[model samples]
Target: MSPDLSLIFVLGLRMAVAAAFVVSASIIAERSGPVIGALVATLPISAGPSYVFLALDHDAAFIAEGALASLPVNAATLFLALTYVLLAQRHGLLLSLVSALAVWFLLAAGLRALDLSLVGGLIANVVAFAICVPLMQRYGHVKMPLITRRWYDIPFRASLVAVLVAAVVTLSGRVGPAITGILALFPVVFTSLMLILHPRIGGPATAAVIANGGWGLMGFGVAIAVLHVAALRFGSAVGLSLALATCVGWNLALWWNGRRKVAVAK
Candidate 1:
């Protein structure tokens, strides 16, 4: 498979734009409140475009096709971030870690049975999710105001929107770029609106962190999409390289931020 330079360039540009929107929106949502930020973060906005990409490539097996085509890694990462917030609101670090690990292993084994070697991706996501749980719990103690009463309705509404939109987009056909762009931009738009509407909430640091994290997640997703395109054009190895690069870049950003916080505290 020869590389399509044109497609690569287009995908890269699309990803950059989408990532910028995610970051901006997340910042706005976080500033509005934890409940709202978590709600927006967990909506799986990246899934629609991802599925559209898979359909474009004509991948038959849903799991493989979807996993490769869409930004599962990115969606899973944000979902994990929101999960950490939810856990911190109700549980301690040890319990949250245990639960996250349990979920990861269970999902990994189940996916493996289906012959998906992408178990590593799932594990990586679980680890990312777990990292935030402890941090949020600790932060909750110092930043009491950050822990808003969980708005159960927000998750329900967000989930409903995510599912409905994803379904509609997936069934719509080869509009991969357009579908993904819309899905990728949804959270940004929602979060930004919320932030503007409710300016007196959450605070600057929380908003920044959430926004940055969202950008990182979106970047991660776009990276996945690039990998899928690469694999289709080149080979599995090339795709794997792109996937690993995304994971490494995201994790590195996480580590860098964590270290910076530690340094500031000292």
Candidate 2:
């Protein structure tokens, strides 16, 4: 293959892989209850693929530094969830999303500016969860409503994930690790959910889904923290593997606990 053709082929392959992964997650999210949806939403569907590509291009040290950048940013996502949930209570989709995004950017900027050490990253997540979790407890349990699936939902989510994957893969070399890590966790899936759900079921119901997402996202914070340590001690490949495992393990524990509760109740 020619250089141009190879580049196109690679980009297409990345898009296909990312789209397939994310669409599956979105399908489960759409079919399952809100808690399940939240768990699916928290999976590394976006960041995982991006980090995989980044690992191919960068070294373990680079991956470790990127995780450091990612830590506070990961914490920032919870605030984005919280901001949207609160604003969505009385606001329309545009205002709520735009406002929530604005809050995310502001908080992300502040957190990133902290010149965070690993401990600082942990503290950021600790503080964010401390503030957001109890509040989310009140809002997270709203029942998932059955709604007709729109024809555009699949394409919309697939496109969103594709664009994000493409951007991260193509730009990782150009932007350096810090920016790459920041871009990797840009909440593309959540944005897709907001676009689809906020209109279908209205704000509060959607907020329930987003609110429950906070728990899963907290696991992501742990994953990044693991990445920071493991990448430096091991290699990027091992680090990424361990980090992904941490996230998967945490979510699995939550799911099992949830199931156990259901069985006990029944």
* Best by the lDDT measure: 2
The C-alpha RMSD in Å for every predicted model, in order, reads 16.6, 1.2
Encode model 1's per-residue lDDT on 26-120: one tens digit a residue. Answer: 54444545434433443333443333344444433332344542343344435434443454345555454345444533443343334323444
Q: What value of lDDT does candidate 2 attain over all alpha carbons? A: 0.88
Instruction: Give candidate 1 misplaced runs (Cα > 4 Å).
Output: 1-45, 48-57, 60-144, 160-171, 174-177, 188-200, 203-206, 214-218, 221-225, 234-249, 260-265
Scored by TM-score, the top model is 2
Span of 10 residues, lowest total lDDT, candidate 2: 133-142
For candidate 1, list the clashing residue pairs, or say none: 49-180, 50-70
Model 2, span 29-115: residue lDDT tens:
877877999999998988898888788878999899888998999888888898899989899999999988888888888887788
**lDDT scores for all predictions?**
0.44, 0.88
Model 2 steric clash pairs: none
* Candidate no. 1 TM-score: 0.37
lDDT of 1: 0.44
Question: In model 2, what is the error at residue 4, expressed in angstroms?
Answer: 2.2
